[model samples]
Structure formats: structure tokens, C-alpha cells
Target: MHLVHLTASTLFGGPERQMLGLAEHLPGEYRSSFLTFRENGRCQAFLDEVRQRGFAGEKLRADFPKVRSVLRELTDRLAAMRADVLLTHSYKPNILGRVAARRLGIPVVAVSRGWTWENWKVRQYERLDRLNLRYLDRVVAVSEGQAQKVLAAGVPADRVSVIHNGSRVADFQTPDPGFDTKLHSFFPADTSVSHVVLSAGRLSPEKGFDVLIEAAVHVLRRCPTTGFVHFGEGVERERLEAIIRERGLTGRFVLKGFTTDLDRFLPWSDLVVLPSHTEGLPNVALEASAAGVAVVATAVGGTPEVIADGETGRLVPPGQPEQLADGIAALLADDRTRMAMGRAGRLRMQSRFTFAAQAAAYQKLFASLGSPTVFLQERVTCQQPPSPPSPEDRNAPTRPGRFGSPTSSTT
Candidate 1:
């Protein structure tokens, strides 16, 4: 099978990382490539990562002013590639990719990472995404909650699939000694022993780093030895920095912008916190679970699916600094409870949420649609169809499906 993946933005985040990871792990028999929008430095960096994994990637500069011409150009390119499926990520590509693929009668699978209505512009994009999703063959939601939202947005329930984001356990299972030493260097010379609280992601408004700052004030008043650190870079950095200064938390709460070495930091953390106001299925929490680090994250999106309330981690209501403070403080105050939760979290990750498991699910989805070299499935049946089937589909028994893929029988 041949697959072409579409991404609107080149910024490296959870969604982008997951797409690249899937491309890397997919079955060798199937050919997969990337179609990226935006040809800037960040996009170039993303291409570098893709090449490192030995995947063919192409970037098209998106000029919104010439959108009609751009879509026509992209549609021509998609026809030339002869890919059986076009899997799209993010709002822009999901909207535009579907439009281009539909002209050729090629199947399009739209990935809904989560609709965070952080601003009017984002909301507008999501509205367009919903409109586009209704036209696409399939919608992959990262969380069940996100799947519900897609259904509510007018997409048929039979057309939405919940595929939880997966992470490599080995990536966070071991800590680099050199990187760990560098992490220690960030601490103040006067501090001999301190409880490290870590949070890492894009420093965006929807991430709720501002709320985390407010919670940090309460945490510091109660526990002075706790050091709070966030590793990410975004437009919210300046605003968060100003809030940290205004709250007089320069020493206690630290912002270490965009560190690629999470293995170093996760090992050193006493506890990890995700104060995001919204999420699909956060990769950070999954990584924390893989590292066996106790997590205190807001009860949002598919977090409840990953975290078993009091079992693996504590979940607090979003935007509640007091409650966020309480959850963090509770985890930090007791080492026994915290370590037990960490162990449970690691066990949960091992049993589920691995990269291999996620890849298998996607491969099944692709196979059920038919081989890329053959005619695509024309029907929109939610279950596996009969007759001149794809090799994988003919050999493997059909499992219950949550979504339908675009299928057209070969004569």
C-alpha cells in the first residue's frame, strides 16, 4: 500500500511527532511519504527529521493569497504520486488536502488532534475542519472525547475512529547521564536537595502555563523546596515570563525553553504536571507514564483514559489554580504514594500505549481499505467488505471498527 501524509504546519509538536513516528514504524511492504505545507526554517527542520528516518518528503509553500492556484497545483501533484490514501493532520491541510484528493476520487483520512478554541482564529479553523471532515472518508480522533466532539460537529458516528496517541517507552525509560548532569547545572548553588516539578510542551495559551504559574505561587507558599520548571517555546513565553516576575517567582518557577532532551529531565523530576486547559491525548503525560513519574494533570480530553484517577495519577479541573496546587502538593508531599503511582503508570504504559500497538491499529485501518496498488474501496461500510480483498484484510480476521474508510473495488 502507498500512503501520502499531509501536514499543514511544520512546527514540531505532539501531532507532528506522532505522524513522523507512524511513518517510521509502518510496515515495510507499504510505501509512505509526507506532503508538508510551509517551506520556512521550521519546515526545513521537520524535513530533516523525516529524512533522518529515510522517508521521502516534499514541502509546498502555502500562499493564502493564491490559495485557489495552490490547491490546483497540489491536486495535480497528488494525482502524480498515485497514493492509495491521503492522511491529513492539522486544520489547514485537513481542509485543503481533502479538497485536492476528492477531485481525483482518492480516499482522504482526516486526523483531528483536538479542537482547542484558544482564540477566534483557531475556532474559525476548527469550523472549517468540521466542514471538511464531513466530506472526507474517515476521521481519526486522538481521544474518545475528541471523537464525541467530531460526531457532534455533524460527522457521522460511523466515520470517526479513536486512536490514542502512542509513545516509545524506551525513549523515556532510560536517562542520559551527561544530560542529567546538565540538568542539575540549572539549579541554584545554594539548593542541596529539592523536589523537582516538571511540565513540558509548547508554551501556548491553551497549554495553560499561566494557570500553572498561579498554581506555582500557592505551591511555593506551602512547599519552598519544590522547584517548578517548564520546557517549551511559544508566543506565550513573554506573557508567562511577565506573570512569573509579577508573582515574584523568578527563582522558584523556571522556564527552560524547548529542550530536546526530555530523557534527562523526566528522570530527575519528583513529579510531572500538565495544566493544559485542553488536550487531545497529550504525549507529555504518556511520556511521564513511560518514565514512571507520577503525574498531576488537568482532567480534560482523553486524559482520564490514560490516567486512572487516584491509581496512576491525579486529575484536577482545568483553570483551577487552587485545585491544581492541591493535586501537585498532594503528590509531592508523600514519596511512597508518589512512587507507587509512578510504578503503576509505567505498568499501564507497558501494557498499552506503545508505538508498536498504535502502528498496528493504523496498519489494520489501511489494509481494510485495500492495497494501494489496486483499486480503492468505493463503499463507506463501517465493517470489512467481501470479495477481491487486500492481502492483509483477506488473511487477518476482521475486528469491530469504529470508523469507515473510503473503498472502491477493482474490476
Candidate 2:
């Protein structure tokens, strides 16, 4: 099958990475292409990677001033590709991609990682996207919490699928000695920093880095030897730096910025923290867990689904610095418990959330829609039903998988 992924992304976040992951790991029977609306900065960077990886892709400069022209061009290009299914990620693509696919009578599968709803503009976009969900042939939510939100928005229960985010387990399982050396170089040779607490993601308000910094202050009072290191860059860098200085946490809390090779660095840390105000099902959490690093994250939006409180890791309430600090400190104080949690987390990741497992689920979704190579044929329109199955094929017992049930929960 020929699948076209449409996205308008300004940054390389979990959703963007997940899209690429799917494209890279999808079965050989399927051919994939990427259509990006924005052609600058991170979007361009994503396109560059897509091209380098030998995927068929196009980057269109879709500016607000030339939206009508861009949309026309997008429709023309999508029609020319003759994709059987068009999968869209992000707000702009979800809204615009669905409209264009409908025009071509092509089926659209929209992905909803999570809605930011951080501000009025984001809320408006999310509201519009929620309304647009009704028109999509299928809507995949990363977490059960997100799936619930989609159902609440009046989408048919049968139309939504919950597929958790996954990561490369072996990458995290294999230790890198060179990265350990680099990690040590970041701290002084004869100074404190016994415990490494990592927080990675874009430095945005929705990520709640400020709340983490506040929680760090409290954590330091109890465990001063601990070092809080954050990865990734964003618009809030200056503000976050100011807070670190003003709070006199410049030494304890370190912002490492964006690192392309997370596998090299993530495993060196003692534990991971995700203080996001909201999330769908963060790939970072899965990466951390796969690395055998215990997580302390907010119990919001599918987090509890991943973290079994006091089992795999701790889950604190959102925006609560006190609870966040306590959760971190408690885990840090008990080495045995922390190590056990990390082991449990790794098992969970390997058993339920590997990249291979995720790819298989998506492949099943594509096959259920139609034949694997339906798009390759000229006469077979995307909307047409496949040829009637043989009696034996119809009687084949259906195996249970991620999409076999209405709601599949790992926890």
C-alpha cells in the first residue's frame, strides 16, 4: 500500500518523531511518502532527514498569506501521489489534510497525540480539530486518556483507536561507555552530583519546566547531591535560565539544550522526570523506561496508564511542586526500590511498548482498510471495497491485537 503522511510541524516533538518511526519501520510491502506544509527550520530539518533516509517526500512552503494557493498545490500533489490512505499529524495537517483527502475521495487516518490547550489560540485549534474528527475515517489516540477525550468530543466509539507510543528497546538496553564519559565531563571531578535526575523535552510552558525548577529547589534541600539535567531547547530558554539564576540553582539545575543522540546520554542518568502539565503518551517516558530508568511524572493524560504508582515509577499530581519533589526524593532515597522500579519499567517497555509491536498494530490497521497494494492499481479507487474473500479466508480466526478491542490498556 502507498501511504502518505501529512504534517505541518514547527518543531521535532514526540508526534513528529513517531511519524518518522512509523515510516522507517513499516513493513516492506508498504511504500510511504511524507508531505510537509512548512519548509523552514525544524520542518526543513525533518524533511532533510526524511530525504536522507530515502523516503519519498516533498516540503511545501505553506504560509498564512498564500494558504489558498498552498491548499490547491497540496491537493494537486496528494492526488498525483495516488495514496490509498493519508495519515495526518498536528493541527494544521489534521484539519487541512482531511479536507484535501475528502476532495480526492481518499481515506484519511488522523493521529491525535494530545491537545495543548495551553492558550486561547491552541484551544481554538484543538476545538476545531475535535470537530474535524467526525469526518476522519479513523482517529488514533496515543493514550487511553486521549481516546476518552476524543470519545467525549462526540466521535463514534467505533472510530477511535488507542495505540501507545513506543521506542527502540535495544538502544536503551545497551550501555554506552563513551556517553558515560561525556556525562561525567559535564560535572566537576571532585564536586557533588551523585544522583542524576533527567528531564527532557522542548522547553515550553506546557512541559512545565518552571514547575520542575521549583520542585528541584525542594528536592535539593533534601538531596543536595542530586543533579537535575534537562535536555532540548525552546522559546522559554531565557526565562528558564533566569529562574535558575534567581533561585540560586545554577549549579544544581543544568539545561543541556537539545542533543540529537539521546541513546548516548539518556542511559547515563539515574532516573527520569516528566513534569508536563499534559501529555498523550510521551515517547520520552517510554525511552526512559526502556533504558531501565525509573520515572517520576505527573499523573495526567495516560501517564498513570504507563506508570503504576509506586511500581514502575511514581506519579505525582500535575503542577504540584511539593508532590513532585517528594516523589523524586522518595525514589532517590531508596536505591533498592529505585533499581527495582527501573527493572520493572524496562520489562513493561519490552513486553508492551516496543517499536516492532507498534508497527505491527499500524500495519493491521492499514490491511483492515483494504489490500496491501490496492493503491498501486490504477482502477482501484481508495473508496472501493476489496474483492469478496474466499470462504476459508472469511472463516479465519481473528487474533487479538492492539486494535482488536475497543480499548486496550497495558496497565
Candidate 3:
């Protein structure tokens, strides 16, 4: 199978990693390539990674406001590659790729990561994306929670398949010798921070970085030696900076812009935090578990699915700084419990979320596209909930799933 993924990636982030990881782990018969919109020069990072991974990648010259040109380019490229299937990521690709793929009689699948809804402009785009998903041959929701959202948006349930994001555990198995020295370098030379609290995501309003800052104020009051570090950058930087200054967290709370080497530093942190208001199986959470670092994140989206509260990490309500602070502070005070949780988290990732399994799921989905009867059978098979956890693994208290009861698939 010749698979081509179309995306409008402004930076090489989680979704980008998932795409490359799937390609790298898939069976040899499946050839994968990537096509990205030229977001000025920002698409270079992703395209470069694609090349490093020995996959063909192209940056599309035609973009939005030039629908006809984009469709022509897509159709021409798909034909040239003889792509068997076209997979799209994000709103722009979902809207345009569907039309182009239809012109070529190729199956098109849209990977539905939850919307950020960062601003008015993004909200409008997401509205159109929700509408467009119904027409796609398939919609792959990264989380079961997101799959529900897709169903709610009028897409047939049979067309939506839930595939949880996988973690690259091998990347975090070994610690970098100089990671500690490099991490501490970000703080003041005189600062005597004993424990580091780390968080990473796009610095946007929907990510709830402001809520994290508020929680940090309370956490610092109890654990004064804990310093907070955030990775990634976006429009919310200035506002977050102003909030930091106002809270007198000058050097204490730092925003170290986007970095491709986050895995290098992840295992070195004492704890990982994700304060997003929404998510679709966040890679940061999965990566943290792979790094054996306990996370204290908001119970939203697919987070509860990844975080077995009290087993792997604690789950707090979204936008509640006091509760978030309590979770962080309580974990920080007890080193033994936190370390145990981290170990459990790593085991969970190893047993459940792996690229090999994700690749197999995709392979089944791709193979089924050739027959309508097989496709429907595949959908039914993929929708069945996961088997119950083993008795030994059921020690942790189960929290009610935010998006109804958690669902999973053999796929």
C-alpha cells in the first residue's frame, strides 16, 4: 500500500511524531510519504524530519484562498505517487484533501485530534472541519472521547475509529548524561531549586497555561524549592509572561520555547504537568508515562484514558487551580508514592500503547477499504470496548470517564 499523509504542520510536534512513528513501524509492504502546506518557512522542520526518516516529503506551494490550485496540486501529486490512500491531519487538510482524493477515486481518512479553539478565526475553521468530516471515507479519532465528538458532529459512528496515540518508549529508556546540567542552566545560577515541575504544549489559551500559572502560585507556597518549566510557544506567551511578572514568578516560571529534543529532558524532571482544557490523547502525557514520570493533569479528553488516576498519576478538574495545586503538592511531598506511580505509568504504556500495535490497527483499517463488507466488519471489530483490566492492575481507584465510560478496541 502506498500511503500519503497530507498536513498543514506549522511545527514538528505530537501529531507529526505520530505520523512518522506509524510509517516507521508499519510493515515493509506499506510505503509512506508526507505532503505539507508551506506555512511560510515553518513546514521545513517537519519536511526535514520526513527526509531523515527516509520518506519522501513535499511542501505544497499552493495553500488556502487558492482552493483550485491546491486541489490541482494534490490531485497531480497523488497521481504521480500512485497513492493507495491519503490521510489528512488538521482542518485545512481535512477540508481540501477530501475533495482532491475524490477526484482521484482514492480513499481519504481524516485524523481528528481535538480542536484547540484558540481564537475566533480558529473556531470558524474548526466549524467547517466538523462539517467536512462526514463526507470523508473514514475519520480516525485519536481518542475515544474525540470519537464521540465526531459522532456528535453528524459523522456516522461506523465511519469513526478510535485509535489512541502511541508512545515512543525506547527514546526515554536511557537518560542523557548532560541533561541535568543543561536543564538547570535555564534557571538563575543562584537559584537553589530542589525539584522541577515541567509542562509542555502550545502556549495557547485553550492549553490552560494561565491555569497552570495560578496553580503554580499555590504549589510554590507549599513547595518553594519547586521550579516550573514549560516547553513550546504560541500567542499566549506575552499574556503568560505578564501573569508571571505579576505573580512575582520571574525566574521561577520559565517558558523555554518549542524544542524537538523534549524527550531528552523529559525523564530528568521530577514531575510532568499538563493543564490543557481539552486534548485528544495528548502525546505529552503518554511520553511522560514512557519516561516513568508521574503526571498531574486535568481530567479532560483522553487524559483519563491514559492516566489511571491514583495508579499512574492524579487527575484534577480542568481550570481549577487550587485542585491542581493540591494534586501537585501532595505528590511532591511524598517521593515514594510519586516514584511508584511513575513506574506503574511506564508499565501501562508498555502494555497498552505501542507503535507496533498502532501500526497493526492502521494496517487493518487500510486493508478493509477495498471492500464495503470488510470495511463494516472492521468498524464493528474496532468499536468493541477493551477487555477488563487484570485483577492485579485494578488496585487504583477508577474515576468516572469524562466522555462517558472509557472505550477501546483490539485495533
Candidate 4:
């Protein structure tokens, strides 16, 4: 089976990473190609990581001219590839892919990462996503919450399938060898043993990072040894920096910007915090879990899907810095508790959220639509091979999945 995938932005956001994950981890038997919009996508790093795993990749420099141009380019590519299926991420590609597939006689799968942002255009975006989903052979929501949003937008309940985004277990290097240089270098050096807190992702208001900055004041006053660091850059940089300075936290909070090497940083921190007001499934949390780090996150979106609240990590009400601060403090105060939570989180990830499992799920979804090679009931399994080990797997979970792949499948 041949599949062509399309997306508008290539930033390493939730949906973009999932698209990369599917392309990278799909069983070698089925052919897949990924096309990203624009010359340099933030998502390019993810695709590069895919190729590092030994798969051929293609990138397209496409952009929006008008609504019609999207459909035209989509149909053009679909025909050129003679694609049996066109899988699309985000709203623009979803709509274009659905319409183009209909015109080109191919199946379409529309995958929803989550709401782009809560804004005036949300209704318009939601409406278009609904229309696009209606035309899909299948609609996949990255989390159950995402599925609810799909139904709330007027798509039928039966039309949406909730498939949690998968992470490349091999990409995680738990002992983040460059923990100091690549990531933690931005933080104030702790001459004495200190409390360290780190958060990764874009610098947007929706990330609730400003909330983390607000919470930092109390954390700093209470614990002078505490060092706060953030990795990621975006529109809210100046604003977040200003808030940190005004709060008298100029020396305490460090904004490191985006880095390709997060594995190094996750292992160095006392804790990882995700203050996102909204999310589908977060790759950072999974990465942190794989690195044996505890997360203090807002109990929004698919976060609950990965975190077991008090068991694996702590979840607090969104937008509440006090709650976020308290949770972080509680975890940091007890070394045994923090390590236990991190280990539990790691266990959960290795068992259920590996790239191989997620790829297996996607293979099934594509095959179910009769686009990718279909599996008979007698086949009784999937065709994706096991995920290759990343630099970090030296201390990772040992058990591999049992999904059988064709012997001819490439490693």
C-alpha cells in the first residue's frame, strides 16, 4: 500500500510530530512519503530524525495561495504519487486532502491534533474541520478529549477514532549526555545542591508559561536554590521575559529557546512542568517520562491519558500558578517520591506509548480503510517492525511488543 501525507506547518508541535512518527515507524512493507509546507518547517527536525532511522523522505515547498490552490496542489500530488490514501494533519491539509482524495479517487484519513488556538477564527476552523472530517474514510483524534471536540464541532461520534500519538522510544536518550550544554546551561549555576525545574515547548500564552513565571516568584522566595528554565521560542518571548523580570526573577528564570537535544536536559532537572492550558497528546511529557523524570502539568487534554495524577505525576487546575507551584514543590521536597513518580511514568510509557505500538495502531487504521495493505482476520496481527533503539535506551524498558511483521519487512 502506498500513502501520501500532507500538513501545513512543519513545526514540531503535537500533530506534526505524530505525522512524523507514523511515517518513521510504519512497518517497512507499506510505502509512505511525507510532504511539508514551506522551505524550513520546525517539523523538519522530526523528519530528519526519521531519516536518521534509515527511511527515505521527501519534503514539498507548498504554501497557501487561496482555498482553491490548496485543493489543486493536493489533487496534483495525490495523482502524481498514485497514492492509495492521503493522510493529512491540521485544518488546511485536512480539508484539501479530503476534497483532493474525492476528486483523485483515493481514501483520506483526517487526523486532528487539537484546536490550533482559542480565537475568533476558532468557529470557522472548527466548521471546516467538521466538513473535512465528514468526507474522510476515517477521522483520528489524538486523544479522547480531542475526539470530544470533534463531536462537539458536529462530526458524528462514530466518525472519530481516538488514537493516542506515539513517541519514538529510540529517540529518547534518558541520561541526556549534553544535559548541561544543550539545555540546562541557561539556568543559574547552582554552586550548592539546588532545586531545578524545566519546561519545554513553544513560548505561547496558551502554553501557560506566564503562569509558570507567576508561580516562580513564590518558588524563588521560598526556595532560593530553585532554578527555573524553559526551552522553546515563540511570540510570547518578550512578554514572558518581561513578566519574569518584573517579578524580580531575572536571575532565577531562564528562557533557553528551542533546542533539538531535549533528552540531555530532561535527565538533569529535578522536575519537568507542562503548564499548557490546552493540548492533545504532548510529546514532551512522553519524552520526560521516558527519561525517568516527574511532570507537573495541567490536567487538560491528553495529559491525563499519560499521567496517573498523584501516582505517576501531579496534575493541577489550568491557569493556577499557585496550584502548579504547590505541585512542583511537593514533588521536589521528597527525593524518593520524585524518583518513584518518574519511574512509574517511565513504566507507563514503555508499556503503552512506544513508537512501535503507535505505528501498529496507524498501520491498522490505514489498513482498515483498505488503502494500505489490508490484513486478513487470519493474519491476526500488524506488519510494523520493532522500533530501533535510540542513544538513550541503555536504561529503558526491556520488553518489546509482540506484533509480527512480514519477514520481508525492512528493519
Q: In lDDT terms, which candidate is top?
A: 3
Worst 10 residues of 2 by lDDT: 398-407
Please give the distance, in angstroms, between residue 5's alpha carbon in candidate 1 and its true position after superposition.
Answer: 0.7
Q: What local lDDT does model 2 show for residue 197?
A: 88
lDDT of 2 by residue, 1-411 (tens): 789999886665667677878877887988999988764555776777788889987887664447687678778888899877999987788888876776666778888888876668878988999878866778888888787777666565556787777766777657888987677567665656888888898887898999999999999999988888888988789999999999988767889988877767888888899999988888888888888889999988888878878888999889999999999999999999999998899888878876666787787677666642443342245445333335564344432233333333456
Give the winner by lDDT: 2 or 4. 2
**Structural similarity to truth (TM-score) of each candidate:** 0.88, 0.87, 0.91, 0.83
- Clash pairs detected, candidate 1: 376-408, 377-407, 377-408, 378-407, 378-408
Q: Is candidate 3 or candidate 4 better by lDDT?
A: 3
Please, what's the RMSD in Å of model 1? Answer: 7.2
Regions of model 3 farther than 4 Å from truth: 371-411
Best by TM-score: 3
Distance from true location, Cα of 224 in model 2, Å: 1.2
Query: Compared with the true structure, what per-residue lDDT tens digits does model 3 show for residues 234-318?
Result: 9999999999999999889999999888998899899999988999889999999999999999999889889999999999999
The C-alpha lDDT values of all candidates are 0.77, 0.79, 0.86, 0.71
lDDT value for model 3: 0.86
Show the lowest summed lDDT stretch of 10 residues, model 1.
Answer: 402-411
What TM-score would candidate 1 get against the native? 0.88
